[model samples]
Target: MSGDGIEILRLGARGDGVAADGLHVPGALPGERVRVGPAEERRGVRRAALDAVLAPSPDRVAPFCPYFGTCGGCAIQHLAPEPYAAWKRGLVVTALSRAGIDAPVAPLRDAHGAGRRRATFHVRRIDGRAEAGFMAARSHALVAIDHCPITEPPLHRAPEVARALARPLGGGGKPLDVQATATAGGLDVDVRGHGPADARARQALVALAGDLDLARLSLHGEVLVQRRPPVVPAGRAPLVPPPGGFLQATRLGEAMLADLVVAGVGEAKRVADLFSGAGAFSLRLAETRAVHAVEGDAGALAALDRAARATPGLRAVTHERRDLFRRPLLAPELDRFDAVVFDPPRAGAEAQAARLAEATVPVVVGVSCDAGTFARDAGLLLAGGYRLAEVVPLDQFRHSPHVELVGVFRREGRRRR
Candidate 1:
């Protein structure tokens, strides 16, 4: 394998530096001349190994994390903030261009300072010693870590918690997935990849939870010790989300997204929140307007319902547990709402978008983590005569390739085509 000096021209979709000859080299940056080894097929693409950066780019900065290149959690930590933000915003731009939809895309909002409120660590017994941390980059090999800077203070202590939990739970050589979520009360931890524990192990786990001062501890959704309910504030109420429930990575990111969605919906009296997880936007919007929250997860909907009922000063906030992927609300059903807000999974709400495209809703707001799927759905709405008002990118998951965006769509008249 010959090491050839290749000049990186741009960053690829996955944050890998790309050469003009189509060579993708990891850990390289644009305007940098890096010596790369022969390309090797990885995940269906031939990627060259970064040997050395012969000429460093002006935009390259020293990574803050010690495990920046080894840990798979972050991929673009070496990039400067300005270039990094531009590359992320360009992800949305490239996606929209590919979908053939032109809209006024806003500058990306930087909301990654609060750090991730949740982290899922891998735990295993190696050489008769318990170890816990994130997996290595693109591999199942576990990298034992003492700390992570990207996570919040509570979540950063997840590795220690995982180790403490594994001592009581793990006897076999199998790896365990420990999900730790930070709450105002304390850390809510969920351990997976192990069978039911015995009476002794359960007691040990209970003691460990007290030692760690965790708000709640669960084993594959089964509660071990619940000192207090892990509650998250939504609009006017505190919602006790289910174990391992989906939440925004950072508190500021959630607020940024919720504010954008609220602005998009305007003063619409009735709104439908589809794929609403734990009422992030639903609860907030319900403060000013009536919101019909629909989601696939029964637990999340239940939490939203309970929070909505207990909370005061909120308008009518109704909910339904329905899979928008398989069965989306039809045009007739959508007509009941003056505005609609949907935040689907990474796969996106394709079927729901089709229905919304056909519906004559005055205002529609779309929130997504996947740019490709968002653009596809936006194109469908554009083809159906909805005007793409704004697309704002949010750096929720910083130092990583993932980006969240909120798209505003409005249709004044009847559906076209």
Candidate 2:
């Protein structure tokens, strides 16, 4: 572990130098040296020359989870905060660059502390009790915990109830994920029975509902009390979200997003917000212009309706709950808008990109999480007579590889295709 000289494993999907050892051995990262193997074993699984993995930090405060080393959930926890911050920033810039979009990622922005408003925790019955924790990396295993270092404080108290309910099910207890959402009212937990929550499981969950100071309670996948019904941010109307709706993790994140959308869209009067879940961008866009929000989920469309009614600023939000992937917006449909502000899921906006390329719309603001998908879709847009305009990366999750970014694109003259 001397001067940054080490063998590289496979390049990360985004090209970060992966460890040659194929494991994050407690105190190592990219740019530090790690001694590998017993001679003959070193030649396994094609290697790269990124011999610069990093070593652990002095303030590396031990990760609390027992499964930290094996769990795939976090990769850079062992490194010092300084390097991990850089890695988080890297995910954004690299993703934007690969998409060939205009990303002005000069002064990287970082959001820290305990403001993560939502987290989905899986629950299971250990020996005689239920254990609750996050899903380990890519596996079904739950990383059981007493406290999660990264979540808001209230979340730590939830496991107490989770374990009590899990105690009865014992070895046969089902697996469930608790989504603690920070709504306008307060923190609401919606429980979805993922693996094996049964009719017998209802009582435990009901008791759990009584223990916490939750605004709303849900058990066995059903809403129990209307302590605080879901609300669309703009409107006072109740938002009936899709079964697994996506909600922003923080109020700051939501407000910042609205600001970015308003700034990016400029003065475009007619616009489309694709994958418009509860009108995250569409509702914001409605402040200045009429926006057509497109999504496939019926519940989300209902939420969109509720939001518009409550917030008059978003009165112009019209929704189409049609699956964009199956039936893309036609050329006639495209002609109605001058721009687009789309925030698609990690899958990226393949179908919408196809239709937008043929449109007269001049601007497209894309917010994406998956790097490869963004690049692929961007390539399609470029082929369709558009050029990358600007890129902005969001570091919402720290000490982790996952990053969010916004890429701005504008229509250019056609050439090849």
Candidate 3:
């Protein structure tokens, strides 16, 4: 295929370079000229494979990781720091503008302290050996790796551990996913994609755990061996999260988000934490104010309750397990709380936001990972006469296109049409 020289204009949401004619070239940076292969239409956009960089951009820098283009984990690592931060902050501004909102967005904050504390490794068999690593970009093929540079020191050897654990379950003849989390005790691991283990397999796993010196090991949420509790620190309390449960990517990221939440809920006596997982924000808020944490996962809620009960000097901390998507807390129940803090998944809390719009809560703080959904929910709150005070974007997952944000809204007056 003949190559064509295309001038890169800007970056798309996924970190791909865009041309004036809407052509997307992978691995190309803005303000550069790149040679690309034959173009093909994909999902209503023209895309081409980057052959070579004829003229590199001034912001381009050598990637630190060896698996820069191969591994699907990090993107936009080649761009300089200033441009990278600008692009990340621009994502929030663009999303809010599209949602018809005009709010002051703070600069992107760096929260990638000590790198990621948790990671999931994909295991697969090739030519009679089990290999563990991340998948290729936009491909199902595995890119076997020895170590990942973006993870914390404790998780540096997670790939090796995942490969060893795959041996017990047919040497990864079937697909397997190993999730490793670095805790205060030791490495907490969970294996998935295999059915229940029998007596012999379970015994082998227990012995392997002993050999690996793992704090806890589980298969599909069933404990195999627990030498010590995998305790993770949240505020003043310690929590033992459930097997393969959700957690913030980095330790510093969680602390930064919790700080913002506490500051946003200033002077509020009663606070309600929605979608509170393992009491990341609730436990911190309970230091002074009474907190009522509501979540869908019973195990997570149980963990939060245990942490709250075990910790001393905390205020009244209560919890309830309910799916907010199906039935959000109505205005009557929400009116009792002075403020509401919700940190939801990528889907955002549309139902709960609608209900909060109807309530008279003085303060509402939203924590989200998706800018588009956050903007949509912010619009809903604005329509209900809530004024968006501030929106702060945090870069927890460094080098990735993803970003996390926190938005504070205050009720201006009565509900508007």
Candidate 4:
């Protein structure tokens, strides 16, 4: 496969094309035959560069972003809509199949509307000017980008904002992590990787924030200056999230997940939202059901509590700041709620899922950004007598290899006494 060409059979889990002889070629799509260069083995798989495309797949399409082939920000942008959607949904299907959880998987939802609201840019000084953009695929080299179409219009201001704070934030000599989040008020910028800022640097950042008209700016988790609170809508209330807080990548994705969670819990009077981040699901569910929002982030919980209190006509929403991984709610404690919704991080909620598996809760909905972990946790629930009703995949991060899903599980028969 080195000197000769190889036929791309299918797209692998990492969005690379796999050949019949098991060679992985980046930038090659399925149903296409391509020539490959000498291979380098990484993680026990032979990876080769796509040298020439002798035949192109029908599903292949021109990428919208000029930086598509170089930037690691997106993969599969070259695919047509129909095949792209199929490949994305196939990720969840394969994961669940491997876990032996056979259930009805719904068609993938297009949650990539208007692009993502958050972007973490990589910034470094080159020559005398700051260069800000995404990293090249599987390399430390940075691809300087003038525009990013996959992000919201406000997030396109990241490069300018990064350049403004580069010098003041001590970013000349080292690379800086510039995380910009688009909020209702304005941009919320969080600068990391650079050393802590001093009083003088703090003053400079404050002035720069005003100049940029930024809503808030923080350095290494410390607020440098805040013109106004960065608010995100959660249900009927607006929540001023903590700097660098976890919110859905897109509002469209949040709405889809919330809708599924609400419908999964049905008309239950009481619901427990695990790993609730600023009440993305808790607050929405509270429109009808009394919600107990539990999370590990104290700041996020505080914001949720404030919103829950201020918002009128919502069912009581109580919050607890506890690490579910270290101390998950036990079966006896979980028995109080009729329905439970858990949206854990990429690692999934194994400890919590183990307990929820045995709990008497009639309904359990699992929301995950990782299909492998979701299937793993789903296996736990299935082994405990829970029936997996349905699994829905949502494409929140479009053109990227990552996939998000919501799984609904129900207890088959009588609850364990």
- C-alpha TM-scores of all predictions: 0.97, 0.81, 0.98, 0.97
Model 4 residue pairs with clashes? none
Candidate 1, clashing residue pairs?
A: none
Write one digit per residue (lDDT tens) for candidate 3, span 225-326. 899989999999999899999999999999999999999988999999999988999999999999999999998999999999999999999999999999
lDDT, candidates in the order shown = 0.89, 0.64, 0.93, 0.89
Model 3 stretches astray by more than 4 angstroms: 1-4, 415-417
- How do all the candidates rank in terms of TM-score, highest first? 3, 4, 1, 2
In terms of lDDT, the best-performing candidate is 3
lDDT winner, 1 or 3 = 3
Model 4 per-residue lDDT tens digits across residues 1-417: 554578899999989999888889989999998998899997899999888999899888888898988899997788899988899999999999998879999999999888899988989777778889999988988888876889999988788888788878666567898899998999999998888767898898899999999999998877888899888888798887888888899989999888999999998899999999888899889889799999999988988998888789999899898999999999999999999999999999999999988888899999999999999999999988899999999999999989899999999875645
lDDT of residue 18 for candidate 1? 93
Segments in model 1 whose C-alpha atoms lie over 4 Å from true places: 1-4, 415-417
State residue 377's C-alpha deviation in candidate 4, in Å.
Answer: 0.5
lDDT score at residue 292, model 1, on the 0-100 scale? 97
